[model samples]
Target: MSFHQEPAVYADLVSLNVKNLKNSIEFYTKVIGFKVVNETEQEANLSADGKTTILQLRKADHDRTNNRYTGLYHLALLLPSREDLALITMHLASNRVPLGSADHHVSEALYLEDIDGNGIEIYVDRDADKWIWNGSNVHMVTERLDAEDLLKDQPDPKDFTGLPADTIMGHVHLHVNNIEEAEKFYIDGLGFQVVSKFSDQALFMSTESYHHHVAANVWNGTSASSPKDGTVGLNYYRLVFPNKEILDQTVLRLNELSYETKDMGAYIEVIDPAGNHIHLVSQNAQN
Candidate 1:
């Protein structure tokens, strides 16, 4: 099976509740280089390629996002190659966009924020063979990336228009109230395995031996609550499963925990402890 395809559980589309639909739409298209697939007065669907809707932006009831709240830390956009990352990096630099760059041993990443202070991470993963693994843990580190070398690897400087067709919503990092509780929900309940960890601060989980597909941290505070209804931040995101059997099993697990869920035919919708919604979709339904 393809590592990124069959039998691999991965994060698909992420929906965000933005303060300004128009402004957020423009920022995603203009700065982030996504194609607007569909748009209504209050909502817009965007894609890296014209065919797949990777992001959904909806206008929120409130104007401000509480940074201290337990919600999205960042939504990661994974590029297909290093060259693609360099091209986008150059594009952002040309526009004088302030960015934070990092080399995580397993991937090189560029971090920035939207107009509403929502965090975004654009990154390209290193080859799977190059990743370091010890037992069940995949080693990941945060260090300054060599931006100059990455820029030098691009095909051409002026070809930056938008993200490539293969770009995807790779992973999402969330701020949770507690690490143990987050792991219990995602790893025990959702069936993801712990792939990496950071003391009491963070935990990373994945399936099929890949790097983390979901990460959670308690950096904000152990008692942080979910974002209020009017606040801006994560609305929901799709967790694409390999098949109906897995999806059904996950739903059963959620029910066992007494968590609420809404069955939507092809997918089941559930909320995390922090109130972030998750749409669990079956692979057959995805097709």
Candidate 2:
């Protein structure tokens, strides 16, 4: 079963504020290999498949801020295979785009920032059987990625056209002020299980045991503030549940925990303790 599909609550679309729509679009398309699904003067929707909108970039109303806010550490894009990752890595290198890479035991990831400095991660997971787990916690670590070995059998960089049609919005990592409160909101309120925890500093939560679908950390100081409105940063993210029953159950749980939710006809909206906006809806309900 696909962890991103039914029976698993996974992060889907993400919206971000960018200072310049044209520049952002160029960077995402030329450097990151995303296709423009649609666009307006102020906003553009990006897709890997040309049909499904996976990311939306909105021109910010104000100038970009350099503050370390409690939101959007990174949004990860999962590729179909390691070969795809290798090809993209070579593509970025050819374009002279600087990137950082790591092997996280469960996955190999390449990290870079958008023109507005929003973090982005492109990754491919290892086989599930190879993932190490100790009880409920998955053993994930940041280690040096063997780029030489990964690129040894890679196809030519000129063969790269764009991100694979099957690529997905894998997971989102956030910066939060309080770990306990964030845990209460994501775990207790939303019903995600703790797949891993890094002492009191970070937590990774997911459903169906497919590692983390959402992760939060207090790495930017415990008092990191939310970005100001119109700042170039995360606008919101969507979480897709398997079905309406589970979505309703999540609403009930959020209400029981005293968290406010706004009903938006097709989907419900909620804010995490650190001020990250979330839209919750069942897979079938999403447009």
lDDT tens digits, residue span 1-287, model 2:
47899988999899999888999999999889999999999899999999899899999877645566888999999999999999999999898888999999999999999888889999999988898989988999999999999999866999999999999999999989999999999999999999999999999999999889999999987978887766788989999999998899999999999999999997899999999999999987876
What does candidate 1 score on TM? 0.96
Evaluate model 2: give its TM-score: 0.98
lDDT of each: 0.87, 0.92
Q: What is the alpha-carbon RMSD of candidate 1 to the true structure?
A: 1.6
Clash numbers, per candidate? 0, 0
Q: What is the lDDT of residue 3 in candidate 2?
A: 81
| Residue 49 Cα positional deviation in candidate 1, in Å, after optimal superposition | 0.8
Give lDDT for model 2.
Answer: 0.92
Give the top-scoring candidate (TM-score): 2
Candidate 1, residues 7-114: lDDT per residue as tens digits? 889888888989789999999999999999989998999999987898999999875545678888999999999989999988998888999999999999999999
